[model samples]
Target chain A: MTGVVSPMAAPAALRGAGAWKPAELLFWTLPVIGWFAFPENLPLLTQIAITALFALSLDLVLGVAGMVTLGHAAFFGVGAYAAGMLPAYLGIGDPLLGLVAAAAAAALAGALTSPLMLRGSGLSQLMVSVGINAMLYEAANKATEVTGGVDGLPGVENTPLFGMWSFDLYGRTAYVYAVVVLLLLFWMARRVVRSPFGVSLRGIRLNAARMPALGVPVNRRLAVVWTLAAAYAGVAGALLTQTTQFVSINVLGFDRSAEVLLILILGGAGHLYGALVGAVAYMSIHHLLADIDPEFWQFWIGLIFIVVVLFARDGALGAAARIRDLIRNLILGRGASR
Target chain B: MTILFDGIASGMLLFLISSGLSVTLGLMGIINLAHGAFAMLGGYVCVVALDRYGIPFPVAVLMATLSAAAAGVALERLVYRRLYGAGQLDQVLFSIGLIFVSMALARWLFGPQPQPIRLPGWLQGQVQLPWIEIGVYRAFLIVLGLVVAVTLHRAVGVTRFGARLRAAVDRPAVARGLGIDVDRVFVVAFAIGSALAGLGGAVGVELLGLDPSFPLRYLVYFLIVVVVGGSGSFEGSLVASVLIGIFDVAGKYYVPQVGSFIIYTVMVVMLIVRPQGLFGRPSP
Candidate 1:
């Protein structure tokens, strides 16, 4: 909580506080480029987008708000179930409607659980989050008739995007749809994290006890951010369900929660773009490693985690920054000597 | 009647497995999520010895315990020693990483299937008690668990090593000033905790099942024991483990559909009511 480097050191435009820079614009365009450049890999690209969004949501909680959680998948699963159930049970297949329902359901869950999270110390908070997740997983597992149990909810057919672009086999439509949602949500998140409210969140994260003395409603702010993060995660989950037309209990699994947290950390926490970078790196590595040996990929991932924690500490981005500083210092020192 | 007996028996097994975790978390302030991996390792060792090498059950259990302790010592010296002053997040991530590595290693060694073990004839079959018959293995587990518990209690309460350990944990600087090797005490405590986990794994294999996913599967239960018992409180873990075991068994028996939902709900409620846990000191 104390050592989280703020995103202020990022280049001004990348901080998302001013007019968009060409690099910022180009970053979003890469997904669009991938849509055309790698048509066959659209499915994987789409998954990467969804996972990035999920990681972004986690960053808001763990990175910005400084809350450590292992149960964020509870919100993701809630959103997924909401979206999936809408089409299967209620015959509402509108993608936009599904997104809304998912967000609301997930946000509601966050609101309900935030009190518990707010009451405990870091260790207790971790335990409470985990406990909540286990309860939800068990509940979902037991509600076979409604959730389709372990077999996963079937017959989730969504209406065409805007009643025009039908999802095709090659996943072109799903890919575009997912990227668009990610862009919109990412844009909103960027704004929120740069706002005064966002600044206050950093303050609370740094020193919660002193924030209340400054007249900041510490618990209320945390509750709001936690809910907002849940909504973002819910949207990610909704996109997953819409693209795949499947909702399995695995969405709520502990692995998903752990995976997303790792993704955020691997990219670098507290930096908005780090989530995006981390997700892409993680999924790509996962894809390549799994191809080489499906079962042993975890071993490599574990090794990476250990190395990262021991050396990089701040993740991939942090390591890059350190190398950059080292080169710059070396050049400056040589110039001064000369 | 049978349900109660079964609940207590299973509870005893739970205490054995989680007692190690409680010790580490309470005394060392390390959230060792990989504790279950050590348990799994012991179970695998015991299984391979008894099934493949034709080793006797008792000797296999002893070997399992020793191996796990050795692994614990190695990890402590190599990895955990550096993480003592790190944040909870780093410790958590590190242990989780260890879990993944151990899991993959287990899959490679054991082929992703639940390991099978053959209990000796003496430990097999039902034992007649005056009113009810109980599985001999379960009865043995209860006796073993109690013996370990009492011995551990006395060791921590009466022995000079225990006094040094308590001194080191409560006031590290003062203990070091008093010529106590705090680091050595921690290493010993960690090994002892891991040995207990191994012992639990060897004996509880038939009941809990052994597989690559064993660590992740039983992680929550161990965590529950540590958290609810309050970190650093030995008796608290015992009480919490027994309560959770009974609840888990009764829930599965009476409401098979709900399964573990009941216990999870209870845990959540307990946490909400007492975030510091049943016997823990209030957070600073």
Candidate 2:
């Protein structure tokens, strides 16, 4: 807790707390470049985007609000199921409409469960979250008629984007759709974290007891942010459902919860871009590792987790920043001598 | 009557496995999510010794317990010692990572299939009683569990080491000031806990089954035992484990439809209603 880099400490001039930085603008162009550079890997690219969004949702709660959870996948699964079921049960197949429905369903789930989170901290919080996730998973598993049980829900159909561009075999449309949604949500997340309300959330995270005396409604803020994060995760899950046109029990599994948390931490939590960077890095590594030995990829991921936690506490982004700072200092020293 | 008997036997097994977790989690304040993995290690050790090495059942079990305890000491010294002051998040991440690594390692060493375990002739078949007939193995479990429960109760409650452990748990700094080797106490307690888990895993193989996925499969059960019992309280865990074991068996037998849903729901409600657990002292 003491050594964690504050999310608010991002350079205002270079990273820009509220405004879009030039570097960020440059970062956004990579997807466009990827679209042209690697046409065959559109599906993988789309997965990275969706996962990034999921990691971003985690960052909102774990990194920004300081509510450590192992059950965030509950919201993701709720959203996925809601989206997948909409077309099956309600006959509403529009992608945008499904996203909206998914977000609302996840947000509702978050709001209902948020009170449980308010009960305690550390180990108790972890247990509560795990319990909630397990309960949902079991419920989903038993409701075979609806969820299709372990075999997964089939025939999950989604309408073409804006009723125009249909999801293609190569996942071209899905890629564009996923990237666009990720950008919009990432922008919204940035605004939310930069607002005065966001600052209070950070204050609560740093010192909950002191925040109450500062007139900050700690519990309410936690609830709101959690709900918002759930909505984001729901949207990401819906994207997966819409793009892949499938929903499985694995969506809500403990593995997903743990994987997303690892991805966020790997990218460097607290910072928005860390989610994006981590999703890309983790997914790429997973892709490579799975190709070699699908069964043992988790071994390497676990090893990476250990190494990162012990050596690189701030994650990839933090390490990159330190390197950049060192280079800048070297350049300044050279210029003064000249 | 059968359900109660079966439940109590299984509950005894749960107590053996989770008692160690209770001490480490409650006393050391470490959320060791990978505790089940150590139990799995013990189970594997027993299976390999019995099946491959032609070791007797009792000898195999002893080897399992000792090996797991040795592994625990090595890990604590090398990895866990560094994290004594880290945040719970770091601990969670590290332990989860450990789980993944161990699971993969187990899978590689033993195929994904459940390892075959053969009980000795003496431990086989059922024994008839006045009101009920119980499996010889289950009866053995109940007897072994009682022995452990009573022994542990005395060890923690009556021993000088137990006094030191309580002092360290209550006030680490003060305990150190009073010339107690807090670190050594923790290491010994941790090793003892791992040994119990190993013993539990080796013995419970018949009831719980054994596979590479053993750790994740039984993770929730062990956690429930510790949490419901109250983290650091030994007596509390014993009571909670039995309650849960009965509740789980009864839920499966009677409801048949709800499965473990009832157990998880109870745990959630317990956590919400009483975060300190049934017997745990409320945090300052």
Candidate 3:
């Protein structure tokens, strides 16, 4: 326990303080702002926004809670199916109610799984979660009469948000709706992470045994955190279904789960912004590479992963930090820093 | 009856491939998920050797195993070395990365389609068992797995090298202090693990065939066997694998609806009930 110093107790070194320049803002944010301002690009912006939120939800578990799950797509799938099937199967024509159902269903499933999952270490936790997802996937595939098998469920006509805004195919409504949801979730996540409970989670993640010794119910805390993360994932899934109006079996696939994990890793887990950066970078690369050569794209992706792991320990953020350091040192001559 | 025999053969092959993973994981506390990928690569290589160069089946398998072993050694030096004591998450991330790299390389070299290897003419045809006729190749596989298992059991359970390896595992730092070459031990263990994976891949392809997703799809089965058998217990892996194999076979053949998926759930239950596995030592 002597060398087991929690990251919380580490000195606040101001690692990225004042590093974001105005030009950098112009370089990144302006394009995004411009794209969103255009009517044609709304759908694309909305998709990115939703995906960013989903990645953020996964970050709550992998990043903040220090729980790595290989089966989070199960929760995502749960939400998607809830939103999709409620209308299609149960004849709940109202999309708003359907979305709430999706979130609530996923939250329920998460609550059920959290206790079993929260007790294990990373490997066992990964295995159990993965097992649960695989079982769910199998069930989803087999329950063809109910789930539509491999063909997927369709015909989801989403009502307008608050009955005032119709979701236009041009993606205007979806984009704004997604943006609002993303902002709200982002703000809530920020508040949650900054709370005392979040502090306790950090403490448990750093050293679980010590927390129990310090009177914290480590397992119970983990269960609650996992459930919250699952609820977030469920929301993302519901949004995906709502926007697409089609729910496929691939939502709960291992590749989806693995990709989410890769995004979190690439984005640098532990930072809220990491999930956003990771989703954007990963999806953009995937889009770019698929356009180049669908067959050979994985090769390039694999190479990038290798390079990221070998060089960028902190991933893309580390690269950004390095560039910032270089610019700062160049401006104030190396000899000027005392 | 024939179904039972076929299932047995398949289970034996899986056990052969997974045993290496179990041993290395037990001793080194390293979770090498890339083990299956290596096996898949071996299967692909053997397929190419037989199909492309018109090489003999036995020769192709030998070449594949040797090449896979070499790859294993290289992996140990390059990637596995960095993962020691780095936590399970790091091992998983790094190994998963390696799996992707291996998969990418396999796809690049062999393409994505399943490589159907033609068994040597001698190994073809069915064998007349007491109750039923079985595929001659499958029967041969079962015998081979048993021989390997027995030989390994003797090597690890009876030999001085096994004793030394156990000693090393038990007190790695002290073993180093006592002048044992710990690095060499690690390298050898990894090589042995990869070799087992290669061996498993070589045999399994005869029945299951070669595919890109082979490694990932069967990863849970392998990990479950290792965990249930208790890490570091070769005999336990054998016992656990056999039990799982029989259960899987019976489940698929008889009760396909319930048992196939429940295997993993059973594993979870077992872990909850006996965290150290049925026969493993309690956590220190």
Candidate 4:
């Protein structure tokens, strides 16, 4: 665990990037530039944005909180099902309430299962989570009346946000909404990582026995962190359902859980922005590779994984950072001229 | 009564698969997720030998079992050997990767669809008892599984190799200092454990359809058995498997809505309250 970057080291990397220091200035200026310059890329960017949030939510447990969950998709699936079904079955047309309900349902489940996870180590926890997810997926498959089973619950008509912003195919409203949510969550997560509670969580992750001996109440803190992470995952799932307007059983599948875990590890666990970079890079490369050769895409992806594991231990984002540093040095030629 | 017979039959199959996993995990501290993958490989081999190559069923089963044992030995040498000193997280991730590679290879070799290797005519019919009639194959499976379980218990409790394996499991460092071939013992331990998984897969394939996805799907089910029975205890797995079989049948028959989740919930509760497993003594 030593030599790895701890989540508590968020010392705001914005100490005068030469000129940009004001948070308000960057917030306003970047959005205007992005919206005006890349109007055509908004849809793709939006998908990446939501996925990035999903990955970040996973990192809160896997990376920061040190909980290796293989069934984080349980929360994600619950959120999607809640968002899709509440409107279709119960006539709750309000998008806001659907999202809230999705997160709340997943949070409740996370809270209930938190005690189960508190005692087990990595493999034990992973097995329990996998079993839980599989059972849920089977239940969803069997509950045809409620879930519509494998055929999926369709005809989910989304009421416009605030009764105004209707989701469009071009993803104009969905993209903006998703991006805004990601930014807000990112900001909140950053603040949380800097708090005293986050410090205690870090202590528990580092040395559980020592921390409990120091009066940390390690088990309870684990449950709290796990529940919070599940809530975030639930919200991300809700966003996916709302944006796509379709919910499938695959959302709770093993592949979903494994891919999310891979994305987090590939992105460098403790680094906040690594998840975004990992998700965007992974999805983009996967899409490109699949399009180029449908049948043998896995071969190339496997090769990429091996290279990343061997050479770039931190992942694509870490490799990119190294390349960027090299280029900066090459261009700048030396330290700042006197 | 027929339902009860069927439950017992299925419970035996579960016991066979889970007992091996329990031993290796208890002894070596290696979480071999690929154990099920080995089982699937064995099932496919048996299917290929019996159906495609016209081999006798018993001979095909033996060949499949040995082939799986060879594969297990190879895995122990190549992947697991490096992972001995690694932490639990790395072991889990690496084994997951191994599962993926093995499954992809199986799918590539034998397409995605499930294959049926017809049971011999002798195993095709049902046998009637005074109270109930059960599938002949199911009866054979239950008998075979019981024999293996009893043999394993006696071997581990009484035999010299079993004593050495047990000593290694209980205290590896001490065993090594006392001149035991600890490395060779681990290799044989994994090989035997995985061979049982292979045999279980071959025998149980008729009950649970043989497919590439079988390993990934049933991996956690066996893990639950291990957790509930307490890892490393063959008797515990046997008892737990029957208990789970009964519980699973009851859940499905009555509260069909929450069929599998009941077992999972029980596992979660057991894990939280007793991390050492139900009958397992806490590892030192």
Candidate 5:
């Protein structure tokens, strides 16, 4: 609690490196460059983009707002179901409308559940979050008429980008669509984290008890941010459903929540870009390792998780910044060149 | 009436399974997710000893518990010792990693499905009561659960170790000045807790359904028992488990469609009603 970097310490390295600045030109253009470089891996890249967005939403609560949620997948699953249902059952393939409905649905779920989270501490909170997620999973599983249950909701057809470009098998449109959505959400998140309200969320995260004395309405702020984050996560889930054209019960599983949380931590939470970088690195490494031995990959991933928590204080992004700072200080002298 | 009996029987096992975790969680503030893994290990150990080596069931339970206790001691010395002062999340992550390692090892060694075990004749049949009937194994479980819970409660609530732990937790410097072996107490308590978990796992395997994924599957249930019952309170955990056990059992029997909902509802309602748990210690 004392020495460990609080999840809210915005990593200056990633903020500088990930932002769309002239020096960090690659941050904005990487997807475009990646589109050209890894032509065959568009589908994987699209998945990475969607997962990155989901992790980003978690950072708002876990990092910026200091809520340790194990049930964040509830929003994602809700979004996926809501979005997929439109095209599958309602015959409405309008991607934008589906995305809105998904976000709205998830936001409502978050608003309702956020109050339940506010009552407990540590283990109680952890159990509640897990409990809520499990409840949602059960709800989704039982609501077979809508969710299609174990078989998963099928027949989701995308209406194309603004009614122009349809989703293609080569994943060209899907990749572009996912990237655009991620960038928009990433920019919006950046705005939210830098605003006055975001700073209040930070104050609450650092010390919620003291914040109310300073006149910050802690519960309201937390609920608001939580709802917003849920909306963002829902959109990400919708993006996945829209591009992949499928939604499964696995979306609501504990594994999905855990993996996204791990990805956020791996990227070094707090910073907006931590999610994106963490998602890319984790997914890629997982992809590589999983391919090597499908049966035993969880062992390696678990090992990675342990090693990351033990050795890497801030995760890969956090560690990378420290290394960069060390090199800069050695070359330019401490506090000399900046 | 039968449902009530079954609920009480199941509740007893829940108490046994969670008491160790509840103690360690409150006293040490260590979020050891691997707690269930130790329970799973105990089950597998009991199964192996009973099936392959032809050990009697009761003896095998003792062996399984001791083995798990030994593992806990080794783990405490080797890994957990370094982590005593670490962040709470770090502890959770570390223990989770350990559980995953154990799970993989179990799969590699024992293969995928739940290890098979056959109950002996005396422990297999049901005994009819005035209004209801209960399995002999369930009766054994209730006895085992009561004995362990009472022993633990007495040991932690009335014994010298309890006083020493309280002193240490309250005023470490003063306790140390008084020559209390705080470290030894911690080690002993941790070992006992692990043994209890192992014993519970071994005994409850048939009821809870053990397999390689045992830890992950039953983690929520264990946590619910500890947190909902209120950490650091033996009485609290006992009460919570009985209530939960009855609700869960009765839910499945009566409202087959919404069984999980019943449990989740209890957890949510409990948290709202008592955020610190029914008898949880006020946060330090």
Candidate 6:
């Protein structure tokens, strides 16, 4: 109850409330470039964009705030079911309003669950977070009248984007719409991560005990960030429902929670872009491996998790940094080793 | 009355499954998410023995327990040993990998179906009493659970090994200086924990049902028990299991609609009231 705190520190590159690097902007630009290059794979790219947004939301709490969450999909699932169900049941087809409502609903849910989570030790907090997720999932399972039980909720309708650019069969509208939201959120995430609030979050991640001594309201900050992260994830989920017009019980599953965690770890958390990078890699591998066998794909993902944990401390970003260092050392005389 | 019996019986099974994980986590400071995999392995072993071969239920149960404990020892040596002092995330990642691999193995070996279990005639019927109607298997489960609980309580609470193991976990350097083989204690404790989980699985198949998802499905139950009982306390696990078991059974029987939501709600409320669990002492 008292001292189950995480000891992970925010990496230096993300600690400063600073200006965006040119390279970071270029990183966001690459997806748009890919959109133009691969016209036939817009659907796949849309899915990736949505997933990257989900992972980015996770990075806020996990990497930036230092919370070890395992049930984030609760917010995501809640948002999806709400948005998807609303349009079908309540006759609200406007996608913009749906997105706002979904984010608010998820944020509300996150606020309710945060106090319970904040009271426990690290592991217990993890258990409680997961426990809430299970409860939400079970609720969805039983509320068959609305959720359609195990058969899944179908026939959610999305109105045209701002009265223009309707979704077509080729998925062009969906990809463009999703990417715009993603870029806006990604920009916001960058700003938040570089804000003074984000700097304090980094401090809390490193040492919550020390932060309270330094006049920071540690638990309050965590709760706020938790709620914020939940909203981000909710919007991401709404995006999925908005784009695909499908929401299944699987949305609230433990697998989704676990997969999102893996994506964050793979992309090398703490930075805003890690989620984007990791999602692209993870979803690509996921897409590629599903061609062979679905069950076995998880086996490879698991192996990737192991490798990332053991060798890549910061995940893909960490590995890329190491590779860059090696090449630099080869090119230069490895002066100062930095 | 019948509800109480079923709850206590189910709770006992949960305790047995999580007992190893609780003790090992307390003693080793590692979260073995793959613990349920061993339980599934036990169920598979028992099923293969009974279905593929003609082994008796009792013998198959014994074989399953031993084999599971043996697997625990091997994994502890080869895999888990390296993560003795590792971060929780690392431990989680590594054990999660084991889970995926075990799931694949189960599917490959068992062909993605719930393994069939045949109880003996004595265990297959019901015992109709004036006060309560009980399945013979439920009665036996209650008895077995009580016996295991008492035995484990004695082994961990009163025995010399228990005293040493406590010391080893609490103060490894001092315990080593005092001539305690910390490594040996960990290995033995881990083995016992795995064996108990296997025994639980072997006995629980008739009630809980076993499929490829068995490990992941029941994993939360085991975790709730270990966590709510206090990470390393057998007595705590026993109490939590009974409470959760009855709560779950009653919820299902009475509400039906809520099912596990009731249990999870209780978990949240309980955690809010006692974040360290009802019995868990705050760690330094």
Cα lDDT listed for each candidate: 0.86, 0.86, 0.75, 0.76, 0.82, 0.82
Best by DockQ: 1
How much does candidate 2 score in TM-score?
0.94
Better of 4 and 6 by DockQ: 6
Clash counts per candidate, in order, are 1, 0, 0, 0, 0, 2
Stronger candidate by TM-score (3 vs 5): 5
- Full ranking by DockQ: 1, 2, 6, 5, 3, 4
Using DockQ as the yardstick, the better of models 3 and 4 is 3
Q: For each candidate, what TM-score against the reference?
A: 0.94, 0.94, 0.89, 0.87, 0.92, 0.93
- Candidate 6: segments with Cα more than 4 A from true spot: A1-17, A314-338
Check candidate 2 and list the clashing pairs.
none
* Span of 10 residues, lowest total lDDT, candidate 1 chain B: B275-284
After best superposition, candidate 3 residue A15: deviation in angstroms? 22
Give the alpha carbon lDDT tens digit for every residue of B238-283 in model 2. 8888899899999999987788898899999999988888998897
- For B231-267, candidate 3 gives per-residue lDDT tens digits of 7777777777777777788777787655457677777
Clashing residue pairs in candidate 5 (N, C-alpha, C atoms within 3 angstroms)? none
Q: List, residue by residue over B215-277, the lDDT tens digit for candidate 5.
A: 887877888888887877888888888888999999999988775777877888888888888
Model 5, global lDDT: 0.82
Point out where model 4 deviates above 4 Å.
A1-45, A296-338
Chain B alone, candidate 5, TM-score of: 0.96
lDDT of 2 by residue, A140-258 (tens): 98888999889988888887888899999999999999999999999988887887677778888889899888777799889899999999999999999999999999999988998
